[model samples]
Every structure is written in structure tokens, then in C-alpha cells.
Target: MSPLTTSSRRRILFVGEAVTLAHVVRPVVLARALDPARYEAVLACDGRYLKLFGELPFAWRPIETIPTVKFLDNLAKGRPVYTAETLRAYVRDDLALIEAVQPDLVVGDFRISLGVSARVAGVPYFTITNAYWGPYSQLPFPLPEHPMTKVFGVGVSQALFNLARPLVFALHTLPLNRVRREYGFPSLGTDLREIYTHADQVLYADIPGFIPTAPLPPHHCWLGPVLWSPEIKPPDWWDAVPEGRPIIYVALGSSGENERALPIILQGLADLPVTVIAATAGQPLGIKPPVNAYVADFLPGAEAAARAALVICNGGSLATQQALAAGAPVLGIASNMDQHLNMLCLERAGVGARLRVGPLTAKQVRKMTERLLGDAGCRQAAGRLRETLRDWDTGQVFAARIAIQGGDGQTTATQP
Candidate 1:
């Protein structure tokens, strides 16, 4: 296809930091939502998930990211995911891409290097993140599934974590600040959230009721939850799952780390009268399945979430959002801070409960699963959120927000 004249179409480039599918899928959802006649879209990211996007119509490029296990291990070890070295490399790639694309706007999903690269390149920058991390948002520090949590127990671990969180945030902020300083940009202080979300525009893919923030600026707007699921053939066992019983769908998601949790979850639910549909997400679990359980390597999440009486996941927002969208409450077995934060909102909205993944037991899993199964209140709360999502066109909202900022690629804070 021939390039359109610059005057005829606005160019937008979406850069993803694909440590997992969520980061990559979020931006892909936005990019696919734009009107091709009005915008020229390009996606640049680590090449790992190119097929996951599955035949993109837009221009695509490969950019290296730190290995997935490296990123996951950092979360597991309670260390910062990015190092100064990593950020420096990212900045270099961001600059190279910006120069090549000459995009009118750059939208990034967790491509933190854009905190500096976009400003230096004179391109308008937009960062997609959860609203809970917004500076103005109200948040609670909860202990995640970790070695410390197991050692100290949930209550004491949370108390100590709440006290040390500021220092922890500061420690994580250093790599970004150090990278920014190296590139002649001043430090964004010590708050990692602030550093993460700093941009010409910050778009949150969450709804207001689920995560209300201190009044946001016009430049910062809610884009709702930009959700996606790959189209794939249903598993052969899919037809065998009886529709007569209450269905429970369990998927720990790609990032949830504890493959060991699968057998425990299956065993915990073994005695239940419900049919359990479980996705190992390509992880192999050695446990023999109960007659009531169906296991697959993957399943279309939205379908499973919609059909289930309840959803159990890693407590990350993507799966939680899908479940809530389907009016199904979730049982979040959270292992990291991100999952913990998502569960915090789910619990607040009265639609979900959080279980620390570190100390997770078959008995505890059974208890929470039973609670969600029997409680009408959880389904009621999920129904309310489901209704709210009905009016949300997340991709369209993201596109329109960027379009309104098109003239000079600058945003005005909701001025009357």
C-alpha cells in the first residue's frame, strides 16, 4: 500500500513492553480500534507475540525486551523489574523507532523509556496503565504472594509492607531516574507510579466505579478496560463440559507463575458438585483430573468467563475485567503487586476475593470457591459492573482521545 500524505492521515505508533500478553494485547486492542481512513497505525515491540496479534493490518517492527523469565523472576524475588542498563537500552530503541516512524503521537503500554525519549523527540506521549497507580488514586498496600508473606503471615506482612512501601517505591525508581539523568532529563522524584505514568497524556483502561481517583485532569482520562482474546478452535473436551451443573472456569493467566496452583485448585474443587473448566495456559500439571474437571492448554477467555458461574485467575485485571464483563465474580490468587492491586479493586467493588498465592492451600481454595459460588452478593456486584461496561467502547474512547489531541499533538486539561 502506498503511504498517505501526512496531511491526509495522522500517524500513531504503539509501543508495547511485552513481558506478558496483557502489555502487548492492551495496545493491540487500541491500535485495532482506530479508523484506518483517519489514522495510520504501527506497532513496535518485542517479537515474541507477533503471532498473538495474528495478522496485523498495520506496520509492525521488532524491538528486544528483557527476557520474560528475567522480568518474572524480578517480581518473584521482590526486586525491580527494570535496571538502569535495561532502561538505557530501551531509550535507545525508543529513539530509533521514533525517528523512523515520525509519528504524530506515541502511545506506549509500559514502555517506561518513553518517559524521557518522547519528550526529547518532541512527540506527544501517551501511557496506558491501571488507574490505581495514578498519583491521585486511592490505594491500599496489600501483601502479595511472596516468601515474606509466607514467613510473616498475611497480616504482619501487610503491616510491614505498608510501612516500607515508600522506600520500596524509591528503590524501584532509581533505574528510571538514573536512565533519565544519563539522557539529561531530570529525575521524576522517587515514586515509581509517577514515573511510570508521566507522559503528555495518561490513559487508564479502567472504569470509574472500580477505581475512582482524585479528580483527574482532562489530559488524564478513563479509556475503560481495553480487553482482547485470541480466536482459536475450542478444545475437543469443551463439548464434554456439562451445561447442567454450575460451571467454574479457572485460568491462572500467562503471568501467574505458580503452575503448582493448578493441581491444588483442581483437588480443592474435586468434591464440589460443579463442573470445573481449567486452562493450564500451556503449563503441564501432573495431577490426574477429577471426573468433574476439564483441562486444556488454552481457552477463549471471554467465552469461558461468560459461561462460568465464577472465574478464578491470577487476579490480574485482564482476566478480572473479562470475568466482570461477563457478570461473573472472580477468585483472585494473586502472586505479585500487580495482581494484588487488581484484587484490591475487585474486593472493594464486592465482586471478588483475594487469596495470597504463597500460602495457598487446597482447603483455602475450596473455601473461597465455595463462598463465591454460594454468595448472591458477589454476582450482584459483578452484574452492576457488567452493566457499566455495556456503555464502554474502550478502543473508540482511546482513539477519539488521541484524535482530539491531533492538531498539535498536545492536550488541554478540561478547560471550560
Candidate 2:
């Protein structure tokens, strides 16, 4: 088909889970990058994300599917937990949606079940995930901890993960593989481990600074971070931010991590000579901010980063990338594996520092924040990295690649 042919306006389906805003926001930005004349996009997600995509220029399809396993509870209990029924339900719903839409291409943002459905439907599919999930993850860095937890924690964790890997695979594949067999779709292979490898493309939604490029399978593409801008109006007090002191933007994403960390952050910033903009995100901690702090339920991250001197966050990729884009240094207090990895990248890139959750203290957070704000070198380094990232123009680069790939229906070789 020619690039300008009617078939070039390929119908695309995007599936996202509303467990977090990252999944919703990333796809919206990519959907916006496609030319209206060249793509007809439809989004499928839970009801919570309905309003999120309502403002976007695309068809919205609501699917009642719970997308994530409750890993947080499992982690806290130091046990492996699997939600088999949830996975099956999601697969069923997603397959129904695929049958209805009949999209030429389907894209999933962190929703692996959607990829399975697309495969069953014989349609090409893509997924956006962190590169750390790939074999390139380097973690378990040295740190002071309880002697027992320090000496045995890593080994125990690794052992448990290895032991549970097959069980986890079976929990998901039992249902999906059964459906594939019933439909005469080729069984995903003898060892069901390959079930996770269904996508035609696996786009790593992280920037180079976070996950440096390395040799990988041909199906993988490091698409950098997807930059998103929300349309929410800033609070009236936004214009009243104090002057002469550096402005620090503090947010813990939208999943209530702020509830635990916000008060500590407030206590840390109490005596500092800086203006703190804390995003409560409608999850209050019952602590009022000090004199130099401005607290809001929500603020558009891009707008806040544009005026920030520094950013304090839970090391979410979206927040960190937005701050880096605005040339702001970061002080990340990470509470999860992914957050820890992203913070490591920021520190290596000379744009930020990290405080792991186990041993984290208000004093250490304050010290790091103050040091980052006071150091001229940190700001200069962040500015340089920001310039380099701007040169990448991540959205435009990915958009052009999509256009090229969709110009003809023929599948091309995937990027490594």
C-alpha cells in the first residue's frame, strides 16, 4: 500500500491499565503524535481512566479488566502471590475487545494480557515496559543494613523469585495456553516461559540516561521515556510561589506513596531556605506544610518542572524525565524496585541522588535536598543532560518510526 492510500490510515488500538497514571499518560502522548489523517486510534481501559482519555481525540472503549497483581502486599509479606482468576478475566475481556475492534495494530502500556489477546486475534501488537525487566538489570547495590537482612536478603529474594517464576508463568499461561490450544493457535511452546515474549515490539519507555543502550533481542526498542502533559489547571496559589529561595517540586506519583513520604518530606524541608511545592494528589497525610511550603492536591508535572530549581519525588519515570527535561536536579526517595533502578540511573547521569526506603530518614532526605539545591555542579550537569535529551526529541523520533512502519502493512525487522 502507498503511504497516502486510505489503508495507510491504519486503525490502531491502545490498551492500558488504570492501576497507575503512567500507563494512561504514556499512550495518550503517543496517540497524539500520530497524524489524524494517517491513523484511526481507539483506546481501551478501565472506567477510572475514562475521563483521562475523554479529552483526547480518539475512540474510547471501556474494558472491565483488573490489570495488575498486588505485588506490594506480596513484597511486604515476603511471599509470592499470584492472581490467576484476575489474569483469566483480563484475557477474556481483552480478547472480546480485540474481536470487536479488529484493529490493524494493538499497543499495550504495561498490560501484558492485551498482548496475548492481540496474538490470539492474529494482529500485530506492541508493549511499553521498563528495560530493567529485561536481562540488563543491575541491582542489589551495597548499603548498610541489619546484618541478617543484609547478608541473606538478596540471596533469599533471588531464590524465591527463581522458585516462583515458573508458578507465575503457569498462573498466567494456564488460561491463555488453554484458549490457544482450543482455537488451534500454536501452543506458545513446550516451556511456557516464552508466553511473556508475545509482542511484535517491546518498547522500553525509559530514557538513555535511565537505562543505557546495550545489545538485546531484535524485538526490543528503547523508545526512551514518553513525555506527557496533563490539561489540569494550576491552583490559584500557584502564582503566589515565594521568591529568592529555590523552588522544589515534591510528588510521589498517584498511588498514595506520597501519604507515607510527604510528611517526612515536609519535616525535612521545614528549616530549609527553599520553597516546597508538595503534590498531595488527594491523598492527605494530615500534616500541614511549613511557612515556605505550598501544598496542592494536584499540579501538572510539566508546568511545575518548568519553574522548579529542584524536584523531590518517589523516582517515577514520568516525574524524573519531566524534571530532567526542565533542567532541574532531583532528590529521589524510592520505595520499590523500579524506583530504585530509575534513581540509580539519575545518580549515574549526575542529575540526582537517591535514598532507599528501608534506611531512609528525614535528616538524610533534607541533607540531600539541601546539597542538591546548593551545588552549582549538580545544576550544570542536569542542564547538560537536559540539552542532550532535548536533542533526542523522543516523541517525534518514535512517531516517525511508527509512520514508517505503518506506511506499508508488511512487518519490518524489530529494533534491538
Candidate 3:
């Protein structure tokens, strides 16, 4: 077969932070989708998702990240997830990887250390992030789950949050700025968005209409949703899932809000006319689901989302994107800024409903679920968004950007 050779090849290393499956899986999807004949694809990531890596034919190696619990705790406390010590450790690991791969270009998903090491190694670096995190994003910054919200009600808390968000973003940027200065690179300024997005090229895994961003800079582009679902066998219950009633799919995912959300949601859906299909994402709900519900450790969320009438999740972009991709409206119980931002965009598009994680109740859940279930307008909006996304091939866009950054493959061919 001659290994399906190409005229010129570049070593493209994908560094994925493994605090959650999303970070790791996003890069894995891209690495596998690259034309291997034109690029030597390598995924250097922690094995938090070792189960999800089997079919990736590219080369791979281990890269450690902080414990997921610790990362979640930081988010819960409204503190920076990565500290100087952790990021310093990450830089050491990242440098070792860059040296090992000798990659022509490195693509990272939330792998912040690459901002320093990729430059030190003189390699081209690209970052994949959500559009809402970009400076040009127009989504309203709702008050995330913060202490301020508890102290002063939603209105006052939101007012204070709007005034203090820049400072908060600045505070989050300190660790990376300190690390960059220590390595002789210029500070990335006060905007944490710049710090988080420091790269030779920046790609947003979102659509312009759904998230509604201002005109992006030349280096930044919307790569659309780099969507991937776990390749797990559906459970026995999947085959016989009832088609007699409206289906509601519930998934909290691994977004640090699993304490009581699933149980509460299940309790709320107990007597509804709908049949609920739920996914725990490998977390156990300490309470049993109602007779009207079915549970799985993980499901092909995209498939289940398409089958259901409404998709309920922790309001992160991953699930909401899946739902929208399937033409299903969303019911989001959002906690952190990321989830809140995603839900806000859905609300703007009129395809979803949002409930605060802190103030959420089973009654609110039931009411919103009923409303979203019956709203033909919401379904129309989701279907419209689905049509917009139907033609976007994120993998193709990602590959084209790599070709541009690799100088149309000419530079790689000339390399010694």
C-alpha cells in the first residue's frame, strides 16, 4: 500500500489538557480526521480518557494534568484552575513533549503551557477554544455562580459582576503572565482571553450566528463545533426506548455539578407524560430514576439527543451543540461562566431555556421542561440552527487552517 504516502508531510502534535473528556476528545477528533498522508499526527495527552483513544491510528504519548477534582474545585471557588506550580509542571512536560515530537506545528485544546514552550521551541502553535471565550464574542456575560450572587441578589450581583469581570479576568491571567515573563516572553496583557488564546493561530469551535461574535481578527477563525461522541455500545434499554411519548434526554456530564442535579431532575420528571432517557457520563446518581426514566453510564449523546424531544444538560457547549446539531431544543442548568455563556447564546437563538445551578429547583426544572417540550417555536429555532450547521465540516476547516499555517506544505517539503 506504500502506507498511503504523500509528497510532503509535517509533524502535527495535538496537546490536549485532560481535566475532562471534552478537552481530550476535541483534539483526538481533529488528530484522527487529519489526512495522515500529509501530516504525522500525534496526540500527547493524559490517559483520563484511555477508553476513548483506541481508534486513533496516530502516534500518542502521555501528558499529565492536575487532578480533575482539584480543577473542578478551583472552578467552584471562582479561582484560576491552574496555578504557577501546576503550570510550571505543565511547561516542563510540554517542553519534553515538543522536544520528543519535534513537531512542525502544535495544536492545543486548553493546554496553556504551549503559550511558553511552543515559542521556546520555535514551533508554530494553534489553540482551539470556544467563541464565547474570545474577545470579540457578543454573548452577554451573565453572572456565574459566584459568592457575590449569594451576597447580593441576581440584579445587584449582575451589576457588580459586569463592573468586576475585567479585574477577574486579569486575576486569572496573572499565572500565565508570570510564567511567560519567567521564560523571557512579554506579558500577555490584562485580558485573560489573550492569555488563554496566546497562539500563532486561534480557532473557535463554534458558529458565528449561534454564538454571535463580532468580527474576529485575521489570526482567529470559527472552526465550528469539533464534535465527538464516545464510541460506546448503547445499553440494552436503548433498543426498546419507548416511542409512544415525548422523549426527554437528561445528561449532567462531568461539569462539576453532579452533587444533586441528576436526582433532582429525575424527581421532577417522575410523573410527567414524557419518557426520560438519562446519561450520567460515568457518575452515579445516588438516587434511582423514576419508572419513566432510563440511565446509562454514557450514551451516544448525539444519537440520543436526536431521538429526544428535549435535551437537558449542565448547559455546557458540548451537550447544547449536540442537541442543536440534532434539531432538539435545550434545557440548561448552568453553573460556571462557560455553561452560562453557552446557555445565553441558546436563549438568544430562542432554542433553549436556562436555569441557574444555584437557584434551581425541581419545580423550576419541571416547569421549564414542560415549556420547552411543548414550544413548537423552540423546535423550529433548533431546526433552523441545525440547517445552518449541516454544511459546516469542522474537520475540513481545521485541516485547511493547518495547511495555511504549514505554508501550503511547501515549507515542510523543503525542511532538512
Q: Which stretches of candidate 1 lie over 4 Å from their true place?
A: 1-6, 412-416
- C-alpha lDDT of all candidate models, in order: 0.84, 0.70, 0.84
How far does residue 191 in candidate 3 sit from its true spot (Å)? 0.8
Error of 3 at 242 (Å): 1.1
Ranking the candidates on lDDT from highest down gives: 1, 3, 2
lDDT of 1 by residue, 364-394 (tens): 9899888988999889989989989877989
- Which candidate number would show the highest TM-score if scored against the true structure? 1
TM-score of 1: 0.95
| For model 2, the run of ten residues with the poorest summed lDDT | 139-148
N/CA/C clash count, model 1: 0
What lDDT is obtained when candidate 3 is compared to the true structure? 0.84
The residue pairs that clash in candidate 2, if any, are none
Question: Backbone clashes in each candidate structure, one number apiece?
Answer: 0, 0, 0
Q: State residue 169's C-alpha deviation in candidate 3, in Å.
A: 1.2
The CA lDDT at 360 in model 2 is: 63
| Model 2 regions lying over 4 Å from their true place | 1-8, 49-54, 65-71, 75-82, 136-197, 407-416
Stretches of model 3 off by over 4 angstroms after superposition: 1-7, 408-416
